[model samples]
Target: MNTAINVQGGQYWKSDNAKTWALAIAQLVSWGSAYYSFSLLVVPMEQTMGWSRTSTNAALSVGLLVSGLAAYPVGTLIDRGHGRLVMAGGSILATAMLVLWSQAQDLRMLFVVWAGLGVSMAATLYDPVFAVVTRDFPTSFRTKITLITLVAGFASTVFIPLTQGLVSWFGWRGALIALAACNVLICLPIHLSAIKRDAAESRTEEHKTRIKVEARESTRRALRTPTFWALAVCFTAYYATFAALTFHLVPLMVERKVSAGLILVTMAVIGPAQVAARALWFAVGRGVRPAVVGMVVTIAFPVSVVVLLCAGTSPYLLILFALVYGGANGMMTILRGTIVQDVMWTKGYGAVSGLLSMPSNIAKGIAPISAAAIWAIQRDYMPVEAIVLAVSLMSASAFIVAMRFARSHPGEVRERIANVGANNS
Candidate 1:
């Protein structure tokens, strides 16, 4: 790893630790204010606006869809060294959208506000941030990515209660306004002050030239490979199951005759479980291969679903399921951030990762409605659970296949470059 400091502009952070911490703070605020706050506001919006639950929720769905659609373009911009502008601009847009949401008097206004929020989500969320980190700390981005997620993982834990308290104190509209203020006051400054264009531009000219050339080849190679598609299938399937189960878990437990108290307990366990799993990995598993980690967590997903399937009203089994599922889901975020770099070369990482994430994000947006449709037909959670389990298994299988391919054919750009040099010689 090159330790020499290459300063492109006077604007970059002097310390990598400072840069990582800044991005981490920005991520926490972004996720908390933009993403997690929606769930808390949904019921309030429905009641206050007199819109049906489905209509209110559809606005969120549209936001998610727009986020998915915007990801590739956002990533392309990041790759072109617009990380600071993208994130800071995103925070500003999100702040405006939140204020818009607070004042929305009709369903049309609600949809329009959320649609803009979706574009902000694409710019401010994990994917674009990951691209920035990968570009900035090319040598040790995995560690930085882990650190960012470790801090950002608390977004839901922090914001859910905070948003609830604000709503209780000042109604939902007031809460939205306060959340908007958080974006403006907290997130915007951190993003603008922390991220510098020189972070990506500071690389040596030779390195930049190499990256440009390899980026094109690596992207072309990746799109042509089975491994890429396999990984995409794995993540898409996993996210679909994850989304469906997440939206339906409480109802599923209720249908199983579990007491409300036990259901809440089970739900509460997930956040801690995720944090614990990530902490454990950071503390002890830093040396472990990401593919190995991927394989284990992918398998854990199915095992967790199976535990829930067989628990049959048993609180102990339900708790067990939550722990396993939550831990896997938590670690999966880290895996998703690092796995592409681990399995393949890092040229064009942002573009490739954006491509990989598009399908999964779309799947996530679709899964809830798809699960609801299944429930509408079956009128029970049994079939839904089974479908989730099946998808989980398929995801695990696809990941295993991708792992094998990665092992067999690693470093596509490196090998291609070596071969071209040899032929010229």
Candidate 2:
């Protein structure tokens, strides 16, 4: 029961659990509103503007590219106690960008809006959010991070349907405008109000004290380490395949003759299962090695694909595939954050994970377009599924390799902590 940090006061650390959950709720709503609205609006946009899906999807790619590139610097900024400001500003900017997007009449304007959305993402998304939690609640960060992601998982389900409703009621432009207003009205106020920091921060002093004792390593030096590349490859390969699978899931289900309603319902399973899996993982996580948990999750990628491939004619198989695939996808989201924290201390974490993740996030941003292009060329999902399965297998291999290296790597965790301490100092 350590007291919360108060630089000027003697008050003990009180777990800002309420504030954390509030932040999580705001995160869920904001991300849901921003991301989930796209799919629902895409068709309407295409119909009105006579734009191809490819053209519309390209805007998303641009935004994601920007978001990926901005991840590292944003992480660094968050570590430096700028998270609240970044989150607030980003929320406001996102609202403004959405307003602009609602008014966009051309692809060029849409691209501009999404690009700004990318900057907004850099400012507001999980990296910055996770940075705050990780720095402040190192011991309990696993569960907290898992919970935040779990809650946010519902964003797609909540906002996607809401977007559809808005479009149905008010048309796409109005829906976009309404969503933008939501960003301002709902998200902005919550973020601004809940994310207050003390002027005299004790974590700053803690970080400084910790950093001075740790060895300094350049990013290059860090990258040269086997664990670095291993993790990068692992995340990249998994996410690339995962992204493709998600983008193509509905189409794949349709091809399998699953009913649209069933597919939609099944898709909804991912979010709730994500939360449930995190809760389960938290309940039993102490019993297993984290790397092992990661390995199991990675293994699910290929298994789920195999189930889907086998699901061609069987409804039961498809359901199974959904359960496994969706649950794994949901849980892995938490594991991504946990894995980085488990591998190192807060020192250099923001920079390292952010930089390593850039390419992976780029893959995430582009995977949908790439998958579609492949589908067009091949005229079958088998190729895509096969590739994802292969990549998943490789990623699992990389994770196992990385774990071995991590086990043997000396001083990495300590070094990271020391670096954070120094930076804070």
Candidate 3:
């Protein structure tokens, strides 16, 4: 109650629409408190604790690494009709981690807290939640997922300033206590009440058996496709670049002599940019295949890096960088959430998304410290920027190849979707 995060989703939220509204509200708190707020905590933690950047970022690395490891099992659990248990449990865990993080002054303890946070992320974030929607509300997932991201996109815009203000008023420790309250008070209640109990979780033995068999078969079909692996390669590279840059963006801007206030303004611009892009997609993207939408955004990834590289010390260029980069990432989340069902079968969606994301999450886990190490080499961010630029190019190339592979392998994908349809019939 000490923190006052604007629950903007309440405007149109209705009790009867708990499926969409509850999950959407929970996502805002979950992402704002557990994920987007991390970078803001970094400077305060560093200044107060006197920890080096690499050492500090390694804690996040630990959390993300643990997230990747936990993703598969979490997905499998959600797919089996345990979405309520998985997400609710994750909120509980996240609350505990945030409280522990507030008290964890020791480096090792910070890591332990973050490791727990990693599990919380796997449970509560987009992938697992998308799996829930995909499995439970199969007919309307794209609409639901897009709406959820549109609402949650404001996490950065809201949280960055809010967290900074909390840090100013209560210090980092007190700010964390307030964030923990958001999880327990806001997100936790929603997960327990919003998500209707899925019938699959309580199906008869025969039905359960049938579900398991179908899930396994769907997973197997996906694994046999070259598109799955190519998409993996694409995301693995893109996420690494994405994580490294976000964690380092402020420092990178400072290195380029961007003023502090301008840096904050630029950061603020990104969240709205993301929201605007998703709004555009929502208005026009439903008819477009997810793969084509993905290809267009994948190109934007390299272009974003190029824009930033060309910006130098120009403030207008920095604003442009934020818009392009944020818009691309916003659409990319949509692609990540829906592409599996579009290209493969919706059966075992949770498991398929988990397996597809594992490698990318691993790369995301390692990137911050890896970029920091490169920064350490020259005590300069030039090499680090160059590396991300190269990886963006690599990511785009891999995604294009993934689309090609998906096109060539259509017969198998059709057969898998057909098999799932027959099961439903």
Best by lDDT: 1
- Candidate 2 TM-score to native: 0.88
Tens digit of lDDT per residue, candidate 2, span 1-425? 32344444322224577657767887887787777788898899998999998888889989989988988777666655666778888889899998898889788999999999988887776777776677666667777877788778778768888888999999999998888888888777666655656455535777544433332343455677788788889988888898889888999778767888788777777667666676777677745768889988888888988988888756677777878887787778777777876765555556666776788889889888888877788688888888888888988899898888888865866676565567555
Candidate 1 per-residue C-alpha lDDT over 1-425 given as tens digits, one digit per residue, 9 for 90 to 100: 21223355434456778778878878888899978998898888777778898888788888888888888778766766678899989999999999998899999999999899989999998898898888777778889989898888898899999999999999999999999999999888777766766534346687566655655666678899888889999999999999999988998888888999999999999998998988888898889988889989999999999999999888899999999999999999999999887777565777788888888888888899899999989799889989999999999999999988887776664575355445324
Model 3 lDDT tens row, 224-323: 8788888888889999999899889999999999899989888888878889999889899889988789888888988888888899888899999999
Q: What total of clashing residue pairs does each candidate reach?
A: 0, 11, 0
Model 2 / residue 12 / CA error / Å: 14
How well does model 2 score by local distance difference test? 0.77
Q: Estimate each model's TM-score.
A: 0.92, 0.88, 0.91
Cα lDDT of all candidates, in order?
0.85, 0.77, 0.85
Position 197, candidate 2: lDDT? 60
By summed lDDT, which 10 consecutive residues of candidate 3 come out lowest? 1-10
RMSD for each model, in Å, please?
Answer: 4.1, 4.0, 4.7
- Which residue pairs clash in candidate 3? none
Which residues of candidate 1, in runs, are more than 4 Å off? 1-12, 199-217, 411-425
